[model samples]
Target: MIRITFPDGSVREYEAGVTGFQIAESISPALARSVVSCGVNGETVELNRPIEADARIALYKFDDEQGKHTFWHTSAHLLAEALQELYPGIQFGFGPAVENGFFYDVLLPNGEMIKEGDFKKIEDKMIELARKNEVVVRQEISKADCLAQFGAAGQTYKCEHIEQDLADGSITTYTQGNFTDLCKGPHLVSTGDIKAIKLTAIAGAFWRGDATKDQMQRLYGISFPKKKMLDEYLLMLEEAKKRDHRKIGKEMELFMFSERVGKGLPIWLPKGTDLRIRLQDMLRKIQKTFGYQEVITPHIGSKNLYVTSGHYAHYGKDSFQPIHTPEEDEEYMLKPMNCPHHCEVFAWKPRSYKDLPFRCAEFGTVYRYEKSGELHGFTRVRSFTQDDAHIFCRQDQVKDEFLRVLSIIQTVFTIFGFGEDQVEFQISLRDPEDKEKYIGSDEVWASAEQAIIDACKEKGIKARCELGEAAFYGPKLDCMVKDAIGRRWQLGTIQVDYNLPERFNLEYTAEDNSKRRPVMIHRAPFGSLERFTAVLIEHTAGHFPLWLAPEQVAILPISEKYNSYALEVANYFDTVGVRATVDNRNEKIGRKIRDNELKRVPYMVIVGEKEAAEGTVAMRQQGGGDQAVMPKEAFAERILGEVAEMLKATNLKPEN
Candidate 1:
């Protein structure tokens, strides 16, 4: 008998060689039917794989992330099988499941192409193959045999991958029906589990993402176990198109990109700058209350600095080439990160243990090199500013600092209307098996990881732990916020690091008068200003809150005669700290109101013959119809009062 441990700490005695399917069957018939995969000792695997010894196991249903990965992986294989039947001599490159769906790159024979019109036929073929319910078989093969099999099948791409990337004993293949490809899979039991199919797009992709390699057709697809689920996903995709940030940003003139300036470099328009400044001021006010001292760093830094901090080793390839100076051996690079410079700031002066928790904040801009194809508006940019801060504290104070940072993140999200239910926390740690990928000793890594875990526990924050997702220096807690459309966006991060301090040789005098290394906590409530603004634009559909809106009020004069009165109202609003713009164009009253409404101005004040003479204005809400006419001073007070109320509701003191 073998001991099997479940997630809830329940143990069961099972005969050796019992499969995960059998284990699920022992629990319940319904569970066995619903389970798509199983996790053995934290590794997801096929349900039919035999468990030969005592292990910890978890059965995964379709709702679980592991189960979806397994399901989509199998669906990718099913797609290849369908293509083999419909288009002979199709060669496969790589097929993997991504966050949304699956994509497979392939070289088509005879210069044939897959078009949008062919999507329906391809999806039909996939569904037909799926109904066969063919079992997927996983096989381990020697490199010689693996190459021979794909070589005989005329799959040159597979042969090349085997030669360059695969080892003799580390090769695996999955076969389902007529299709066999290179894979190390944790796949679903059979193709029947994929009941619905959609072929989303076809794009040109170079083999292995290398520009020098042959371009292949990449087919993107999605599958679901239920037809209704696929229907809902299609509906969500439609909604996403309507909420695309790039589209809204252009319409609202929030930000722009110029080919002449450069791709992936965003230039904030006048209104966008106004909105961004407000965002910065709001965070600055909150940081002040938390004892954070703001600082600024240069846009370029010595490459040696990053080399010492280990960022050069990790991100150097992705960063722009270093700038060479007239002086020999002197080089600088556009700042790829702000932490290393902040480390220098801490090392600039001597300190005692009393100054241990030194908090420094910066809205620092950094630049990186991104492939043109990979850049997306503000979300993926070449240059962006981080609302970054570092806390240098004693090892014992790590947890307390984490709690404080979490409070700030929570406050920021709450102000943006992201409730607790809409947010998720992920604890990302290093992968023990891949020690080469991360810096620092195992002891320091463990301590830092444990501190974050303990902090989350004390805060009553339930976070999912993911291995191999940590920064090269240390573990981190990341925040993922689901927007109004239910799409998740990563917005905030807090990392605990002990490695950078040691690298920089930063120290402070201890209570016993001996030198001690201070632990470092890296945090950013808004991971980057550009990315955060993009997500906010999409989340709110470009309709910002009154306090954050670029143009809070639009004053429209009913006629050319009332233009002076409109300017007077705008002047009065400016005195009262209300951001108002006068629309004094020669258009009619209705046209002016419609234009301002489309601009997403929160309030529009109409100054007509009666209002100009009465020294009052007619107020109309953005989406709401006309509110009652009120005196100019009363209107200004009302706007300020509304803004104050929003801040008060969030438990934040409004800044003057």
Candidate 2:
């Protein structure tokens, strides 16, 4: 008998070689039926895998993320089987489960092609295969045998993958019916478990993700055990399409992209620029209250700067190629990060313990060379501004500084109406086995990691820890916010670093009169101005808050006759620090209102003969029905009052 420990710390004696499925059965019939996978010790494994020694186990159900991943991974194999049946001689590449679904990359034989129109046929074939309920069999194979089998079958992609990527002693494959593929799987027991499937989209992806390699057709799809769940997922996807920021940004004329300017570089139009400036001002004010000193840095830095900071070692390949100087052998790179420049700033001035926690902030625009296929509107642009700040402090001050950064993130989220439940914190730590890849001594890494964990504990913040997710120089805390459509986007980040200071040889005279390295904390409440705005555009569906709205109010004249009164109303709003515009074109009131509403202006104030004579304005809230008419001053004051209340609640006392 061996000891098995449950997550709750309860231990039980079990016979050696007992499978996880048996353990689940021992717990309860309901649990056994619901469990899709199990965690043996810390690794996720199939329920059918036998355990022969003492272990810690956690059974996973559909509600758990790991279980969902396992389900989707099996769905990918099922998809491949369906495709092979429908299209013979279909060579396959990697087909892994993604955040939402699964995608299979394939190379069709005889010049065959797959497109969106073929989704229905593939979906039908998948359902037919799923109903057969074929059991998935897992097998461990020798690298040589795996390559030989795939090569004989004319699967050059599989043969290449096995021969190059797989070690001789570490190779596995899964077979379901006549379809077999190389995989490291914790798959569901049978294909029939996938009751519903929907093929989402088809795109071109490079084989092995190398741009120079042959491009394969990638098909994206999702599966569910129930038809109703699939329907709901489809509905959410439809809603997502409607709320796509790219479509809304173009329709509202907020931002644009020019091929002549660049592919991934976004150009802020007049309205977008106005909105962006407002957001920057808001963040600037917030940072001032937190004692962050604003600074500016050059857009280009010497390649040696990044090399010393350890960023070039990690991001150099993907970044824009170095620019050679006209003079001697000097090369500069477009800045990929602001931390390196900030490190230089910290090193510029010697300090005592009194200057321990110096904070510097910048709206720094950085450039990186992302693959052309990966670029998306404003969200994934190559050139973007980071709402960046770095804090240089003593080791003892690390926890307090992290708490303050957390407070800033919480405050920003609250002001934006995101609740605690709508956001998640992820603590990313370095990989222990890959020590050479990361900077800093083990002692410093431990202290920084512990400080973050303790800080979150003290704040009562629930977070998940992810290994191998840290920056090359340090551990990090990331904030992911889920939008209205249930799509999660990374919005903020905080990193603790002991490596940069060491690299730069930055130090401060301690209270004991000894030189000590000051720990660096890198944070950004809004990860990037461009990406945040894109998320905001999608989350609110372009209906920005009154304080941040590009145009808070639109003064719509009932007719050209009341244009003067409309201008007066607009001027009044301007004086009150409210953005407003007058629509005096020859258009009907209904048309003007509709147009402004589509623009997502928060309020529409109409002026006509009666309003002009009475010196009042008619109001209609965006998405809200017509509000009662009121004096122009009363309306402006009401809007200002609401903004003040929100700011006050958030404790955002931006510096004048």
Positional deviation of residue 233's Cα in model 1 after best superposition, in angstroms: 1.4
lDDT of 2 by residue, 1-656 (tens): 99999977899899999888899999899999888888887677888888999998888887677788888999999899989998889999999988888999998998889988899989998999899998889999998899888988889899989878889988999999889989999898778768899998899999988989999999999998889989998898898888889999987789999999989999999989988898888877778888999999999999999998888888998899899987778999999999989988988978899997999999999999988888998889899999999999988889999999999899889889889889999999988878988988899899989999999999999887777789988899999999998888999999999889999898999999999989999999999999999999989988787777777788999888899889988887887777788989898888888888888888888889999999999988888766879999999888788777767877754221
lDDT of 2 at 405: 95
Clashes of 2: 0
lDDT of all the models against the reference? Answer: 0.92, 0.89
Model 2, residue 20: C-alpha shift (Å) = 3.2
Clashing pairs in 1: none
Task: Please tell me which predicted candidate would have the highest TM-score against the true structure.
Answer: 1
lDDT of 1: 0.92
lDDT by residue for model 1 (1-656), tens: 99999987899999999999999999999999999999988788999999999999999998877888999999998988888888999989999998788989988899999888988888999999889899999999999999889999999999999999988998899999889989989998888889999999888999888899899999999999999999999999998888788988887778999999999999999999999998999999899999999999999999999999999999998999999997687899999999999999999989889997999999999999987767998999999999999999998888999999999999999999999999999999998989999999999999999999999989999997778899999999999999998888999999999999999999999999999999999999999999999999989988898889999999998889999999999988888799999998899889988888778899999998999889999999998755979999999999999999998887666553
| lDDT of prediction 2 | 0.89
